[model samples]
Target: MEFYAGSRDACYEAKSAGLPKASGGCLLANASLREGQLLVGGHPFVIGKKDSGNRSSRDYYSHKLAWVSEKFVVLWDEKDKRGWLVNGASALLHIVMTSLEQLSPAFKSICLFDPASIQEGKHPHQPDSATEVLLNINNRQLRIYREDDGPPRFQGQVEICYNMLEKMIEYQLIVLERVRNSRIIVPRAHLEGWDFRHLAQRFDPIYPRLAVLDTNGKSWVDFTRSIHAVTLFGRGFGEIIRPTGACSAWATLPCGKYYLAACAADLQKIMDGHGGQYSTPLRLTDDDIWYIPDKSTGQCLCKDKTDATHSDLAQILLPSDMCKNLSLNPSGCYQTDRGAFIFGFNEIHQWFWNDTGNPFRKMAGESSDLLLNPGISYMSDSSVFRESLGIEEVRDASYLRLVPQQMSSDNYTVGIICALTIELKAVGALFDSTHAYVPSPDHDPNDYVFGSICGHNVVASCLPDGDYGTTSAALAAGHMCRSFNGVEFYLLVGVGGGAPHTNKQDIRLGDVVVSTPKGSKTGGIPYDTVKTLQGGVHIINGYLSPPPYRLRSVLRLLLKSDPNPPKAPLQPYLDQIAQSVDGCGYPGQENDQLFDSDYSHLAEAETCDSCDPQKCIQRTLRPSTQPRIHYGLIASGNQVMKDSKTRDRLGEEQDILCFEMEAAGIMNTVPALVIRGICDYSDSHKNKGWQKYAAATAAAFMKLLLSNVPVSNDRGQRQQAPMFSG
Candidate 1:
């Protein structure tokens, strides 16, 4: 682990040259990286590699860079085996890391680095002492085995425990895309200081289990046979298990008998307690299943379903409220009282807090842990099964990576971007069926959730939680295009502010606004810049590219086909969503008032409850509360339009029907259409009461829009939208 002195000059800003030939298309002159180690943001990186095999090693690791602007140079720390991402795409030489660390334990390593603070010395060796010396796990202390006068108990409990382990492994493999498999076993373990810390703090209380990750940094397997397992975080890592010196050939396989397994010491204790009587092992049925009584709470109770021998699992597993539903039964199994909303599914995972750690780790010391080994950890895209870890170690070309053509990102023909989590949820509700999670390349930052609508495959994404504004939206759309290049068109669908540019427009809360080309302006957001002149202040408007010809044409066909129809085409979908999910219905006309242009909301209030009702502009009520769809230009900017004066001026001057933060940033990046559900008036009176309903309206319309889009490879103009049935 030695290297020659690399270039001392902070990374050479190679403008137009030195990009790897493999990345020809992404070779934007604004950004470039070379093949060797370069000091970036005072750290180091081995960038732009050609040979994937030579890219990373057991000691060092590499991950795909979703974005690499000259301003934000991501660097790899070979010493710590992690990659560091700088904050903001435009922060050149300003190495301010995002607060991803604060968000979750998974990302606690991401922090503001002061190059001067790094002590250039080895970590002070911790001398092994009485406090540091940990012991081999004693299975007896796990408290998993207990006895009664009847028969040897806990066979059913052990099966549940084994199933719980499998459930944990399955999520890591499919959803988290971290574990290679779940059969990693070791005859012995040498727990160290780090292992002792994680076991006591994270695993011992509730997340009880011993999971092992490969040193090659590939995948992980949980060996929670009976809680005698060690907690090994990927970092601070000391190898616990391996082929010990010689060839230690062992086949780790799943066994059902592991549930009722007993040692000689346990048998003697049982015999002494029961007056020299030999106890028979109880046979459990329904290997690994959880009977969930409340799907909403996601709380469950388990039953062995064999002879009535299983203990009351609900008392141990169910939440406090669930205690009411679970009833005492003669079979020893906790049963949900008759006619309860119970379903059966087997998945038991520790509740996750974030990239950092869970709620349990919050009160503890600031200790970091990589839940999965990077070697086998799939990219952020939850393509957990991206690679197959052979039963034996990889010696040659034995493992084959299978990526189905249908599941490829290229097959996802449409892209949907939501600025908020609520918007994401609204749009996701309309998906006919979600596609399987696929692994993404290292460079792509977006973790796409794929779904289908009327045979159209859509890759949906939302701005990272708590992030908004045009720049973030643009960065997200840029990554979306690069990750899912085959996405023909994108929809920037979410909630926005209503302007009601003209009296005839009749816009209100829970109404849908679509960007439609008017004269020289292709429908999109107009960002107006204030330009001061000698006589008067003039506005210099920045325009963006319109939606693609294909989408605009389809919109026209859709409108024409259902011109003056009996009702709104998206009503059915909106109703379905409202019925399925709570609080996504129309907020009622009383909650949908528009304040006068000069009026302002009462300060420091969450809602308009404190404001004078007289300030609300009186308008003729529509025959029905169904939202009217308006097609016009929208004003987009980085700032929220909360000032009533500015909202009116911009609406009148720019002829804008709606205002939003993200559309302007995305319009230039992709062939995108901006569909906004008017939640607020872009005024001080804006409240969240209408946001969910507004989001629903926008999503409903987008569903209607996509329903009219024929899935066949026809980028040309679409005919009448016969699919629209109001």
Candidate 2:
């Protein structure tokens, strides 16, 4: 056991004067030695001050115990001296006393104390210190005591008392300053040249805050990375800067060399574009440690400097104009008029007359400016970047596509600018600049029109003969074509008649008479009877055609704009037919009934050009302008009637309005709706007036129908794109 007691500010002691060297000793290793702690042989002692600079050395107190072997120390209780002295093997008092006589004079003075004195209960008389007392041993115990406890009284034998008393006196003498041996500071006189006092003023006049320090730690004012044996109070020599008006000096840790001891926050300000000479500190790229200059220059003078890398910015275009005037092979490099350049490839060469001829490659042997080859690069002729430069290489620049200035007004001013990729398939053969073709109606086994249905396209074909048969055949063909093409509607256009009718009739021969859902029995439609029934049959009494709901709105607007709707002239021949058909006598009682109807007068005579008695004739053809229109139903049959009896019977049986030869053949495949300008009664009294005027009426009516039919695109919600139903 070992113990400690009294105030921490105390002297230390040792024992064992003039004795044989002993093997063991004990100490209060945790706490610095304090006064009144019992030493070997019952002597009291005190520990010394740490101010002597010996606090850091392991051997500072070791010299006092030189007589003992390094490994052995006896533990004893400072206050309760009755406890056993712990040695490796028990020895007699005589042996221990003799061993103490062999110790060195210095070693004889050091004391062995109890560690338990440190545990003395807190008392008013004793001032407390933070140091702890540790007794190092195997199973060793410590004891603590107050000064009033008096020196420890040993419970063991009093034999060899004089020798023990002698050892105790020597133990008390062992107390010495704690900092007796160290090496980190210089005497005050040695720091005279350091100028630490005038650090603020002696610094460079312009670089006011800059001060120099000897990086080597050879003087009191100097510093090193660590403390040496000479350190002040056993610590390193560090700089202490005490600013004016400050009670305490601020300390900075010693570094390998001089270091700026400024606030890291202030250092950051210098690096952030502040107006200071050392605005930015040089940094070691790998580690973030900054090298602040000793002098106030912005540059760093450290041997381990750093390294780094950098980047830039740029625009693009071409060299010259190459439109129409370009030759096959030109001499020299055919530069763009602008001279800004890039190498050209076959892809670019192919596009020489592309979107807006931007000559890319020029051939050799032709004039460089006038002609171009197939492999040179040139400027684009488009004015997209016109403000930059002008291109003039003697080529027809006008050939470059010129967009109308009005495009901006309609918001379509933008054009595509594409870079060359690979060649496109040769598709120009199907188009003549204006129209782009897909598959043809003839070659296409599907029987589809070239363009129809979806409404985005148009289909155009010609009729060799312009008559009801040809026209009706075309209409039938068109309807069939539309169905095959997935077209949503049909348009029948060309010419037709304007006729007089009995319902206050006053229609001109040439003026258009558009069909309005009119058809008579033998067959009839919902659209026919609902609004068109009059005098026992469906008939058109006016010129306006029935427009599909969607197109009707816009067509109405167009019609409203026409100021002379009623004054438009009628065809001369249609007038003659109307007059003739009105006078023609009917056959039998059926004839009387026909004359009794309002549309009987409207019926014009059908005229046969060749007067062939074998073929049936058309009464009249309807007129229209828009191609999507169709005339109301006309009769189709095989009988050619020259007799009044047959004509009246035919009329009575079929309620047939106008007769024709081909429509029935067509109706088998197409949904037919015939619009006939009533031509004649088809009796024995057919006249020359019937032939001329009927033809005229047919032509006029055809024109009228065409004029009235709504354009397909304007028809009710357009049909969707066709999918392959098969």
Candidate 3:
């Protein structure tokens, strides 16, 4: 290679621009080359120029920018078959070179330039005896094979052997021989600097045949057929078959066969054993499967019809104390074992038990390893799949992503656990007039609640906001941040507008509204009474949420019997709320209906003065006929229903016992319950005056309910507690 001079100013300019410095000014920038384009520097460039000058054989070589350093720029060309650096000397000098035709297909050689400054070189390379070579693998190692020679001659004689002649990517294979022992074949990459002891940790001694298959079987093609089959062997069972090119293929051992396979790739290779090549030719096939024959069966011993009964399963498995009873009601397949409850048509996954004890209460769906056709599911309105599902090869498109309609709720479904995280963003009063008070600093935020009494319930209120605007924002933030980690069936306890009947029925100003699942039946109601009144009415409108069976039973019992209704005295809480409103700073609006509504004039015999609350009721609002707590249907929609007309419209359509906010958002996200205290008539009369009192009442009721409920502790049991029995 000959030395040539370019421009002295140009060299200084390139150096100042963060490029390598040279005696010649600076190499003019390749205006046509993109940032990542490959190029050769110094010696290769000088050689190319000389070859062209001589008019002899034009150097048939492709140049590539290996990397760049501050003082020196490394470059490679096929013709020179060596790596060289361009420095300030303007001399063609070899630095380090690899005897190879092309770079590894995995990582391409590209110019490294600082995006911040065009003149600055991209990569930082330093002088070192052994350069840290990054091999871009075109083909991955597939299998490990071993051969035994009578009395091994060389012990720990590691030989790096590679089939350089093959068209496929050239990968180094390490062959280690133990004197008079078997020859071990492993990929040079995996065994490099690997401690034999550490390597042994990964290999199980009991399982002689080591098996490494793609966890996310993304490749549709059989592995036995892939041409890029890299094999390794460890005299005995220490064979580690790792894929070098891509981790998409699935590997399996054939029945009664000792050899592992990379059967999918089209390339064919023979297994070289201790004596010679293995007798059987390894090929990729659908039926071919391999496993390290274990004395212990891999089958799950949870006890079923095929093996043990519920009693046997309960005893054989640990944590038997957690399991209570196995209700094999319909069939043995869908039986409920004590610890883990399986709910499905048969063995097919319908849904599994989210045992309360489990940190993440969730149910996993069936997953596949196919890259093209990934698995997916709907979780709280979000599409979920897995990405990069395997060991970084075969790109995984299957990832779980959630997109909720109501981002305000800050609600999201937890994919790992198959549960919803509910945020109770707002539970406040936007005071109209009527002498109602606005939410203030003095008010207790704990007045809000979300949970269940029949079982486990959660109730909470927003932290105080110094300013109303700030308070509202904080409340929204809090609700949006309301996340249920793994609890099953989230509940919301708060206040809502309630219609007052002639006799006030059995409900009072501070009663509870144990809402069913959004679309669940409340009494005879279908639960999804959205638009108009029909033959039967449901509790909620908008997105439907079916209440769990346990709640349904409890509510039914409460409705049937109201002999001793209003179990707790909510009067004190109500009175406190009334007084709090008196301190609010905001003035009443002229159109405030709170002042105009005549609560005293509306008597049992007379009709409602403003909006008729009764017209909204699809059916007669009868007092509880059952002996349990009074549980009525509630409605939930995105919009806050304050108008008596709209309330009546929804009521007549769905027979909603109360109207409140947050439940729809909560229920849609998780297993949620709504407990609302009757504050207003849910009509035009809704005002701030009732908010304090209603909130207090709701809070008290929630405490009463929480004290009496119990949740299952088993780690794999489905939530199945009954609500009531009317």
Tens digit of lDDT per residue, candidate 1, span 1-726?
A: 010001111222211111111100010101111221122222332233331233243121101111111111112221233211121111111111111111245323332223333222231111111011111022112222234321122122222222222222222222111112221111111111012122212222222112111121110011121111112122221111111121111111012111111112222322233222221111111111122333222122223233333221111112222223444323232222111111111123221111110111111221112211111111232332122111122222212111111378777888999987677767766654444455666786665566666556778887776789988999999988988878889999999999864535889889999998887877775565556688886775667898898888877865675322435456656754564346898878977778787877778989888788888788888898889898888888888888888877777767788888998889988899999999988888888999989999999888778755655444533223221000
Model 3: lDDT of residue 570: 33
State in Å the error of residue 147, model 1. 89
lDDT of 3 by residue, 459-495 (tens): 3333232322222423433343344334444345556
Query: Judged by TM-score relative to the true structure, which candidate is superior, 1 or 3?
Result: 1
Misplaced by over 4 Å in model 2 are 1-486, 492-514, 519-566, 569-633, 638-657, 661-726
TM-score of 1: 0.45
TM-score of each: 0.45, 0.23, 0.27
Best by TM-score: 1
> Candidate 1: how large is its RMSD?
28.5
Q: How far is 418's C-alpha from truth in model 2 (Å)?
A: 47
Using lDDT, give the best candidate's number.
Answer: 1
Residue 417, model 3, lDDT:
13
